[model samples]
Structures are given as C-alpha cells and as structure tokens.
Target: MNIEHLNVNGMELAVVSSDEIVIIDTQSALDLAMTVKYETNVANIVIDKNIICEDFFILSTGIAGEILQKFINYHVKVAVYGDYSHYTSKPLKDFIYEANHGKDFFFVATRDEAIQKLTETQ
Candidate 1:
C-alpha cells in the first residue's frame, strides 16, 4: 500500500492506495487505522472503496457496520471514494446517505471530493 499524507485546514490526513483489498474484516480495519496513525500520526484517512471488501456494501453481511465501528472506537475518521453508482441496494444507499451527512465516515465520488469533505468541519 502507498500512503500519501496531506495537511488540510490544519488537519493531518492520509490517502492510502493499494491494488488488493486492504480491509476484509473489522480487525483489518482497526489494524489499518493503527498503522496509519502510527506511521503518519494522522487520525483521518482517505481510501478507495475498491480496497474494501465487496461484502461491505451488503448491509446484511454486517461487515460495514463492524469495520466502521472500529474506526469510530479508535478515533479514526475515514473517507471512502469511488464510483458507487452501480450499487442498487436501498439499504446500502440509505446507509451511504446517512454516512455522508455525518462527520466520521464519508462516501464520495472522487478523491478530490473526499479530501475536501475530510477537511471541512461538520
């Protein structure tokens, strides 16, 4: 994985890029947050949605909730950026909508937007 660090609005942020799925489960999510924080001293992160498991989009799988909870518990703010237009599940859509309105988690269409959202205070 490649981590690019940025300072926005006096906030430290890490943008991670990888070819494979980085977060397959809740443990992995916590590990990612800890690793990023330790390496970059950043509590905020921006990751591509493709690096996350596909099951995370399926609300019934419970992967999204579990992994996101880990981020919250660890005080890590995460922004996932990608093309989400293909997903048709209503529950997932609603989940995304709700998350977009919150401070901790964000779902955006582009990396620039993700960075902008992370920098803004709710």
Candidate 2:
C-alpha cells in the first residue's frame, strides 16, 4: 500500500492505494479516516477503487450510504477513483453522477481527476 499527501485547492488530501480492500464497512471507513487524519492531518482523501469493497458499488446492500455517512460525519471528504462502467444499475449510475457533482464525495475515472474533484469545493 502507498499513501501520499497532496496539497491542492488550499487543502491537504491523503491519497491511498492498497492491494487489499481497505474500506469494506462503516468501521473500516472510520478506521481509514483516523489513519489519514493521524498521518496527514487532513480530512480529505482520495482512495483507489480497488481498495474499496465491491459491496459499496451495490446500492441494495446500503453499504455505500452508511459508509459515506460515516465519512461525512467525521468531516472526511472522499473521492474514489476507478472505472465505474461495470455497474449497470441506473440508480447506482445516477448516484455516482450526482456524487461527482457534489462537494464532499466524488466518483471519477483517474487519480488525477480524483484529486481535482476532491479539492474543487466550488
């Protein structure tokens, strides 16, 4: 796993890439928030999609909502970067599209895009 801290848009963001699934549940989301805060003192993060559980992409499980809520409650703005074309659900696609338009959460296709989206508050 590699974690890097970046300064962008007047905020610091922790970018993490792990071979294993790092965020699988709400608890994992808390854990990651703590880790990133401790390491970089940043509430913003960009994580590789491969490090997140597949369940997060399945809206039926409600995993994504809960996990994202935890991030929000903890003041952690997150951007998940990867290929989202595999998900065929319209709701999920709409969710991602809307998230990308929001300030706190984003789903993007690349690390650079993740950084850009995560940092752009306006």
Candidate 3:
C-alpha cells in the first residue's frame, strides 16, 4: 500500500493507494477526529472496498459503517471503490444505495470514478 498526501482546501489529505485494498489505520476515534479537525476543508477520500480475508467478511459491514459515521461526523465526503457485484446480500446492497444517496458517501464501481468523486467534491 502506498499513501500520498495531497493538499485539499489547504489541508493535507492522505490518499492511500493499493492494488489490494485501501485502509485507514487510525489508532482511535480521537486520532481520526484530530485528522478530521485539521483537514476540515478536505472534501473527499477514496478507500478500496475489496475484502481479502474470509474473517474480514464478518466485520466488514461494521467497519464500513464506522468509517461512514466518521466521515459524516466530520462533514467529509468519501468514496469506496471496488467490484461489489459478487456480493448479493440485500442488506449490503441497500446500505450501498443509501450511502450513494448521501453527498458524503459513494460506492463506485471503478477506481477512476472513486478518484473523480473524491477530487471533485466541493
């Protein structure tokens, strides 16, 4: 995984890029809150949504929700990019739809779209 810091609204935003999965490994809510507070003007972030481990499946939804809550609490936008066609869970699909409707969260099919969404957020 590679992380690049970009200037957005005069704040540094971390852009994590990886062929496998994108992860934000903030130690705690306070850490994330600090990052968000400092990067308040940052509009969006792109995260890889691919699940690599079987054990992760159980926690993925909660993790996704937690991330979304953080974004919402901070008034930041986010885009999760990956192929979600393999997942046919109704609840998951519904969650995706709900997230897409919000200006803060987007579920994109391609990395290009994710980047576009994150960069274009105003």
**Candidate 3 wrong stretches, greater than 4 Å:** 5-14, 19-43, 51-61
Best-to-worst order by lDDT is 1, 2, 3
RMSD after CA superposition, every candidate = 1.0, 1.2, 4.6
**Which residues of candidate 2, in runs, are more than 4 Å off?**
none
TM-score of 3: 0.63
lDDT of 3 by residue, 54-116 (tens): 222334547556656766887666676778788767777888788787677788988667767
The prediction achieving the highest lDDT against the true structure is 1
Ranking by TM-score: 1, 2, 3
Across 5-64, the per-residue lDDT of candidate 2 in tens digits comes to 988867788999998998888898789889889988988889999999999999999999
Candidate 3 colliding pairs: none
TM-score of 2: 0.94
Tens digits of lDDT, candidate 1, 3-73: 89998878889999899999888888888888899999998899998899998999999999998888888
How many pairs of residues collide in model 3?
0
lDDT of 1 at 30: 88
